[model samples]
Target chain A: EPEVTQTPSHQVTQMGQEVILRCVPISNHLYFYWYRQILGQKVEFLVSFYNNEISEKSEIFDDQFSVERPDGSNFTLKIRSTKLEDSAMYFCASSEAGTGHGYTFGSGTRLTVV
Target chain B: AQSVTQLDSQVPVFEEAPVELRCNYSSSVSVYLFWYVQYPNQGLQLLLKYLSGSTLVESINGFEAEFNKSQTSFHLRKPSVHISDTAEYFCAVGAAGGYNKLIFGAGTRLAVHP
Candidate 1:
């Protein structure tokens, strides 16, 4: 089956450094999303993208965070000056339709800020 | 906003035994329900989903979930499980409208032993 692909299975960075996470959603998918899971916690929605712009975002998605569909196929999340609390597993997901349908998720990038 | 609650943190059962993972959600509007499974070090995979029509949905792996509107529940079940079924299962809720973000539960870990 087709899948969403994410680069950098793990990343470790200084607390104040900038980090960019990349994802290639399924070829036919129209909606993209980013979610994060802190250790032993519930998965939290960060942002949703469609038609090359952000459709919605959660409170956790603040000024420090930004998402872009840099190219036609690649979706990227950039965190400027990451904080220690930013350490978590970031998952990229895509769906052909919307919430009424199921989503396909990438393995996830484990971001660890020191 | 929608919220999902997984009552059990962990459930241990021997191979060939039956199991159920409880899930409930609170939502003001119509919602879509889904169950996802995540194996160790892997991405989340859709187990099943309830969008419309029948309240019960089933996956190819013998897992099933019934969406109960009145009770606000979507509990996952399996009549017989295998060792390979061990994983963390998450229940999620999303708005019925197109392109809505998902709200996920903390997750329930199922450990199927031989």
Candidate 2:
């Protein structure tokens, strides 16, 4: 089965530093998304990207968070200034068409902003 | 808007015992429901999803869920469970639009003890 890929399985960054989480979605996927889960909390949607631009984003995705599909394969989420609360397992997902078929998710990048 | 709620935070069951994970969703418009499973230290995996069908959806791992429009619920069930089934399960809701984002519920940890 096709799979979404995420690099830097675990990342440790100092608070107020910049961090970029990278993801390589399925080659044919049209919709991409980023979500994060804090310790013991529900996974929250951060942002969605389609057609080389952001389609939707949740309240959690403030100015500090930005997503980019710089290339055909790599989709990256950059945190301009990391905060301790930003520590969580970040997930990258992709869908072929619509969400009706659900999404294929990557193994995730555990970001620890200390 | 769409939202999901998973009723139980944790459920402990013996191997071979039946288990049910309750999920409810709220959306002003028709929505799709999904169940995602996360093994320890792993990313979320799509277990099953319910779009528009017989109101019943089944995963390859012997798990099933029924969508009830009236109750606005999509509870997952398994007649028997194994230790390998122990994991955190998340319920998600997505609006019916062409490409909408998903809202995930607080996960339910299912522990199948031997």
Candidate 3:
């Protein structure tokens, strides 16, 4: 079965530094999303992308965060300035063309902001 | 906004024992429900989902979940778990619309003992 793949499984950065997490969703998937999980907290939605545009975002997805499908097959999330609180597991997910279809998630990129 | 609640934060069971992870959600309108599993240092993997049709859904790995609209629940179960099944499981809820942004529970860590 096809699975979502993410690059840089682990990242370490100093505070105020920039970081980019990359993912390649399933070949035929249409909708893409980014979510984060703090050490002991629930997984929270950050943003959703479709049609080369951001469809929606959460309050957690502030000015410092942005997502792009730089290429047809590559989706990325960039943090302009990383804060200590930004340390978490960032996950990328994609779903087929349906409102209620199940999504496939990547292995996740562990971001550590020191 | 939708929210998911996982009653038990951790569930301990012996190998070949049956186990259940309770999940509940709060949503006014109809929504899609999903269960995802995450092995250590990995991203969430789709276990099963309830979109339409029968409320009961089964995964290939002997895991199953039932969607109960009346109680707003979608609990996952496995008749016989293996050591390999030890992981973190998350339940999520999403609106049945274009975005399909998900709200996840805190997660339940299943520790299968030998």
Better of 1 and 3 by lDDT: 1
**Lowest-lDDT window of 10 residues in candidate 3 chain B?**
B93-102
Cα misplacement distance, residue B28 of candidate 2 (Å): 0.4
Q: What are the runs in model 2 whose C-alpha is more than 4 Å off? A: none
Considering TM-score, which of the candidate structures 1 and 3 is the better prediction for this target? 1
Off by over 4 Å in 1: none
**Which residue pairs in candidate 3 collide?**
A107-B43
By the DockQ metric, which is better: model 2 or model 3?
2
Could you tell me the lDDT of residue B108 within candidate 2?
A: 98
lDDT of 3 at A9: 94
Compare the candidates by lDDT and give the number of the best one: 1
How do the predictions measure up, each by TM-score? Answer: 0.98, 0.98, 0.96
Residues A1-114 of candidate 3: C-alpha lDDT, one tens digit per residue: 999999899999999999999999998999999999999999999999999999999999999999999998999999999999999999999989765777889999999999
TM-score of 3: 0.96
lDDT of 3: 0.92
By lDDT, rank the candidates, best first.
1, 2, 3
